[model samples]
Target: MPQSLFSRMVLILLGGLILVQSISVVFHLRERDRLLFRSNSMESAQRIADTLRLLNSLPPADRHKFVAALNSPTLRISLVTPPSSQPRQSPDGANQAASFGMMLRDLLGENPPIAVTVSEMEWPARQHEVNAPYRAESIHPRQKTAFTVETHLQDGTTVSLDALPTGQAFPLPPRLLLNLLILLAAVIVLSLLAVRLATRPLNTLASAAEKLGNDINSPPLLETGPTEVRRAAHAFNTMQSRLASYIQERTRILAAMSHDLKTPITRLRLRAELLEDDELRVKFAKDLEEMESMVAATLDFMRGVDNPEPLQPMDIMALLESLQADAAEIGHEVRLQGIAAQPYPCKPTALKRCLSNLIDNAIKYGKSATVIVNDDDKQLQIHILDHGQGIPEAELERVFEPFYRLENSRSRDTGGTGLGLGIARNIAQMHGGELVLKNKAGGGLEVILTLPKPITSGSMATKTGAASNIQAKKPRM
Candidate 1:
């Protein structure tokens, strides 16, 4: 199916807006997560620091009890005392004490001036790096001094022992997802509304354009909408008005010219009647007759060009039969072919003039004329066939130009002014129809005139009148 410009525009706009909003939502979530993570990390670090200070003031036995009571895999406590006189030794000897002293010395070098050691500890569920140490100070508030502990996670985050429990480090905010969803919905709805509002005027402009070709006299379009839309509509309306006025002016000029030429042509014919020589008088009269015919055909052609008659229903078969009988009466062989069954909506006078010209041309040039009326549910086609010297492919289109006769040889005997086909085409177009000329399969030329079907009650009435007239005239009777 074909898509309208307005719908396509809205679709493109909405799609782009959705894409941009989606990217924004992603970035917003990332930024929010970063902020929440930092906040949680700081709070955990502060709690851990406070816990370590409390642990350092307790005696060794009480400190062990406190550590056991706190029992968290993420936290550990240790006590270290310096040797009194000789080097202290256990079953493992100097190596163990030397290792422990070196680790504690490294911890004291870290910031906050507290001794702490970290060792990799492996367990069944997870692995951790834990460290803790104590120091004695004279100015300390407690009996001895203070100890500090630190833990590190695999993800590159470090927590001080004085920090709070990592178990409650950060919890996801409950309303965050709901708020994001609301924002997303609002954005989509607002975008769609904006698109609709912006494209409404464009739709109106398209509709107006479609109608313009068929009805040039339609009222000016409503120039409302965005600034650009209003400007475009105003320009279009101005162009339509100018085109209509130009056509009207041209028609008036042609009518005036035709009226003015008739007086001189008539006077010349009257003057030729008094000529003394018989041969000369006959030739002059013949010339005058030819000139008069050309003048009349030219006037008809010009009138059709500008003032198109209104549409009415016409009997397709009847119109053809009338032309056929008229040709037969003139001693020309003419036949009616196909169905004369249906009536179509068209301009009656314009359509009749168009078909009459076609038949006249056929009879004049081909010496015989045949008309066929073909009808379908949707439209009607009228074909006028003539057995004559068909037009050359090159001259077919040129034949429809005003005053453009075929070649000198063909025009000599026929006395054609070359306006027949041009006038036929003009009449056909006035009725929203077209005239097409083509070479027949066997010989001669076929002229096809196509007209639209009627759709209203008033059209049906007009069609009935034309149909009755066609049926009343019987060739046999």
Candidate 2:
């Protein structure tokens, strides 16, 4: 039921330890009961047989005095007249009596007639007197075992002994539970340490995997610890190497192809310029220009995949202001809102290109673009919204595919290569961020760019020590 491996392992180990402890306690109690009962029965039977033999050897007048000598705290000896009939006993009491009587007969032979009866009795609570007839050590606390043994001697004198001995039930060792608790606590501590050590490698591997997504050039995992964990780390490092090599090779090939195609495109453009019919010349120039644009866009897309830009902390507001000024110069309206609390870690050029493409799309399809920034310790979000007809629901995700576009948006009149959204998304992913599109309620499209902040050693300290501005900035109209 536990979600974490550490918690699950501790629960299983603790459960098994408790179960084994319970079984051991039960078995110990049973064994203690058997040993105590045997010793107590044997001692009681031997004392009674010896008392009867001593009375028979002495004269009747002196027998009573000697009986007082045989008395003890556990056993009381006295003289009694023989009973007319045997006393009735419950089945369990009768069985105990029979067993005790047989033990007496085996010790004393058949000469003396002996009768034994066992009955359960409770000790009075008020017997706390220090000088009572029986010592506190000789009496049981709650239920006590009461037994009466009678023997008829050779001269018809009857001797009776009543025993209310202690140790009828084995007293529990006072430190049993305390010792078990201590053992359990120690074992639990050891189990936690072992489980944490065992799961540490898994945590490292997961962190390495996440880091790998952010930067293909990130360092490989260290191959240490157990054999299985070492093997997994080695495999992950190998896979990362292969992926990086493949991307580099693909980028080199695309770069060569783009270079090879540019020469032909230049020649075609020059030849078209020398044509006699102006209309035919314009059409040929347009076709050649479109082809050249497609080839350049494809190369850009490929380069975005394997961009080698390093991350650095940069002012987000300054970048947005630069973009706003550029759009203003081009006669396209762009508004900026909100403030970043701190410099965000990012590949500056790649992130700028990503935002530029998104803002351009908004300006092209929608009338104008408004960029809103929301920043925190965990992540930075920039939302670019527009004021034109929004994309259809079915084509929202499909528009991100390379060279794919809506019927109205990707026409030749619009002068687009249809790879802008794909290139933007690729750049966002390379920075360990995401770009998402959604239709706004008031009519237009909204592009959300989410960039996660990298966690560094001093980040937490800085966050705790620095004062943050929570008030939002108003958008420029």
Q: Which candidate is the best by TM-score?
A: 2
The TM-scores, one per candidate, come to: 0.65, 0.78
lDDT of 2 by residue, 130-181 (tens): 2456444555546657678877789987777877644446577779878878
Q: 1-477, model 1: which lDDT tens digit per residue? A: 228655676677667877887898799877765565445444344545555555655654576677656544344433433323432244433433243334433433443433233222332122323333232221123121112344432232233342222433355567876886787788778867877888777777776775565456667988877789889999999998998888778777866877888889789988899899989999999887887777677677766665556656566667776777777777888888899455566666656677777888887778888888787765678888889888888988999987887774358466777777887787666655678999998989999988655456334644366443633321110
Error of 2 at 213 (Å): 2.4
TM-score of 1: 0.65
RMSD of 2: 6.7
- Index of the highest-lDDT prediction: 2
lDDT of each: 0.63, 0.78
Clash pairs, model 2 backbone: none
